[model samples]
Target: MSESDPHQSGRGRVTAPARPSGKGGGKGVGEMIAIYDTTLRDGSQSESVQFSVEDKLRIARRLDLLGVDYIEGGWPGANPKDEAFFARAKDLKLERSRLVAFGSTRRAKVKAEDDTVLNALLAAGTGVITIFGKSWPLHVTRALGIAPAENLELIFDSIRHLKARTDQVFFDAEHFFDGFKADPDYAVKALMAARDGGADGLILCDTNGGSLPGEIAAIMRQIALPDVRLGIHCHNDGGLAVANTLAAVECGATQVQGTINGLGERCGNADLTTVVANLLLKMGRHARLGVEGLPRLTGVSRFVDEMCNRSPQKNQPFVGASAFAHKAGVHVAAILKDPVTYEHIDPEQVGNERRILVSEQAGRSNLVHKFREMGILDVDPNDPRLQDLLNELKELEFRGYQFDAAEASFELRVRKALGQLPEYFLEQGFRVIDNRMVRDDGAWIMGAEATVKLVVGGQPVHFVGEGNGPVDALYTVLRRALEWHYPAINTVTLVDYKVRILPQALGGRSGTGSMVRVLIEWRDEERSWGTVGVSEHIIAASYAAIMDALIFKLYKDGATPAV
Candidate 1:
């Protein structure tokens, strides 16, 4: 590290003409800004996000379908799982993406040909290879304990060595942004070393994730190198990875390296989810992401989350559940009239839909919109019943019911108010018993039994079920009691059950007596829906949610409507 200025914005400097965004070059509207996905490598580095080899393969398949240009699988020999991934990925047969193998430049004392790291990269059997090397003078001197010149040789030798054996090679200038600020001349030299070594592209990394957009644009303008073929790899520690990447693009950088949902170590990497949408929709630029790929953005986002065993972020931009939801009465009314009034692009363009939430803030327009969405087509803005429905919705919301996440229950309520719902079955009450006993080994065994009596098709039915808990027992017995009458109920299963203690429901009671809210996600082969119930007793709350789910399923499956 040498000359530095934390406040220096690289302003007024002329930037070189932009190169083709991908190695397969083209310019203008037809040219694509290659999307380089590192989710299998970098995203797996996220805290608590460990992808199995199978998970990596699944994600790679999905990314290929989405038409990303490059997929960096992982460092092959860095770990056993990555090794397995590459071996398994050999048969992956990606249609749209070229598989990439990642590694570092040769170690300080090692020759490029003999370096175990480089050998492992070649062994991965990928068509493309990307290697990172120190760019900062301080890192060259301290981190590598070598002269700056020797480090340059290491980078050049590593790339040239791989280039002779492989088709294409890329150099990731680690800490390039920070290094440029410290010693602008040395950082540029690092990229030059890779270029001279026959590297296809030079990736500038904001390793510290602290660089601002102004700094990125300004620094990019300072790079006067020819045949730059630049790429930008940003991290999100400063909450500016997406912004910085876009800035670099504005200054002529082509390829963008990031992970899905911004998953990575520490704060995270640039979110390809936001980057892709902005590139195609906002900037009106092109990418290798296919013609139909843009609409599948939300599906890809959620699919990655599912593979990571993480829940989808509702408030995430573009593809989030709440991105298109309008709750304010004024906003909903305007959006209903013309989505352009409140939305940036059509939600369907990104594989999402608009939601008009019915709550205390809602008005006639919200109820009318929501009722129609639930198939109550007769709802009118001027109808008195719309007002009554709105009042009931508010009252229910006041009692701790959230309709947005639990739409099945909300749909059922709307149908009932519209006289479109008929009683499919009647509950004749239920009983649950809990038992615990100590075994000879001093271990305690626990069991719960529930007896449910329901009158279905005017016939009384009784069933007893056992489970590890009262709620499970109740659901088992109740679902069993209904399956005989409604055979379609057999496909319905409880996929997820969530319980929350709402102190506000008990007027600010935070103790054990606080009312509980239960939300259960039910799914069949076709689709899934969420149902909710709130009660002072957990068991009762569970029962209410379970019953609502069954009722909703039966109703949708052609249970006779009221005469």
Candidate 2:
């Protein structure tokens, strides 16, 4: 190992020179890294990720719009859903991305044309096809029960067969990194076989995802094929997928494959969001996804989560809710002076915003900043009123009120404290009763009824309603009571409802007496807002949140009836 050689060190570690400022030609400042999104395919393999046929279509369109170079639609032969997705994709009007169909290489001793998986890939009607073959000799002998020499033949035969069918064929050398570590000659031979068989690109896969960055770069440098293009596919089992993928790129790999939000099997795959961000912002790569599409990165990440029915990870890098949120007083104060003081990148560059979170740790700067954003702009940063408001917020947070996700509720509280909130209605009282009866056939029937008394527009209004549950019954009666005065209530719809039992320490009690926090998401034709409430009684907490949601809607709409 010589100092002049960047590929090896005295300690047997692989090293690479600093990333070149210019390599693959593009408009950007750094080398171009092709963005290949497998969100619709590999992403759906996550434990909680299940994409409907429609979800696949929507995500494909989104990825195309985001300017990814390729969108892997999934293995068409694996399930009917994937087959249907491909069938439906024929009618899709994609602008930029090339749709690719994924499948394994030809089986042992089988002709590629005779393989059902290969036929399915052709039937998918995609111009591009990606077939993964076992690069590790161990997998060939153990998993496929084939001779190592025959495995190389399978790789060559599969790519040759597919090359005849399509002009663009990508060979995924599965477990390439691990296989290289075990037998470097076999791994290089497997890739060379694919290249010789007309593979346009050979993607080195960290299938087990245990390779370090140094190992990936060192091995990539050792590959002898200089003419064939290289790509990288990394899993996150070791939590180094992103680092390894970037290291491969730094070593001159032209393309990177990953899933949105890192959704995949086991620990998941490299997150395309993080990969693209690091490529463009950190490495200055001229990626297929340019600076223009970067702002929509956050929305794209959330859309995929919505389709998968998974909560967006707040701490996820680049696009998470807490990614740019400042909570500490010192941090908030510095961020107020200059966001770059605490944030690595401008949130708006990624279609996110810097958030000043107000908690017990909040300073006067936090209150002032949040107040201005909420349209309560008259408060001074050093005023006693701001201190009072901060004290109230801390006390409420002590009572399990999380204002981070319920900014509308927090605004209402501040307005009320400042005596700026209008009195829209007064609640007199509300009651709910539940009755259960068993029929002769041993079927149990449960019914709930709720009555609401309120003074709206100086008029006493009483209403009663029945529903499947107490909360529904209460909402029904409340809406009936307010419809005449506030027709806008008809436009408001409850989109989502969530409840969580606060921990005993936060709930200020134990057992059944502990407080339940309710978060309600409401949307009208214009926009959506979330409100939260906490109470020992679930119904009461739900009602409180419901009221807050309604009030927020009315306030936003400037609805001022003579109440």
| lDDT (Cα, tens digit) per residue for candidate 1, span 1-563 | 11232112222122443433433222444446889999999989999998999999999999998899999999979989989999999999899999999999999888877999999999988979999999899999998899987787888789889999999999999999999999887787788778778898889999989999999988887776554578899999999999999888776677999999999999999999999899888886788785479898899999999998989999899999999989999998898889999999899988888888878888788887877776667556687777788899888778787888898998888888877888988889999999898989999999899999888878888899999889878888887888777778888889998988896644646688887889999998888999999887888888889989988888888866221
Whole-model lDDT per candidate? 0.85, 0.85
Per-residue lDDT tens digits for candidate 2, residues 1-563, read: 12332111112212333332323111234456778889888988899777999999999998888889999999998999999999999998999899999999888867888998899999998999999999898999999998887787788888989999886999999999999899877777788778778898889999998999999988876665545678999999999999999888878788899999999999999999999988888887887679889998999999999999988999999999999999889998898788889999998888887888988788888888888887767666777877788899988888888888888788898888777788889989899999798989999999899999999999999999998888888888888888898888888888888898888987458888888999888889999888999999999999999889888877787889648
Q: What TM-score, over all chains together, does every model reach?
A: 0.91, 0.91
The C-alpha stretches of model 2 lying farther than 4 A from their native spots are 1-30, 439-442, 561-563
TM-score of 1: 0.91
Lowest lDDT sum, 10 consecutive residues, model 1, at 1-10
lDDT of 2 at 7: 18
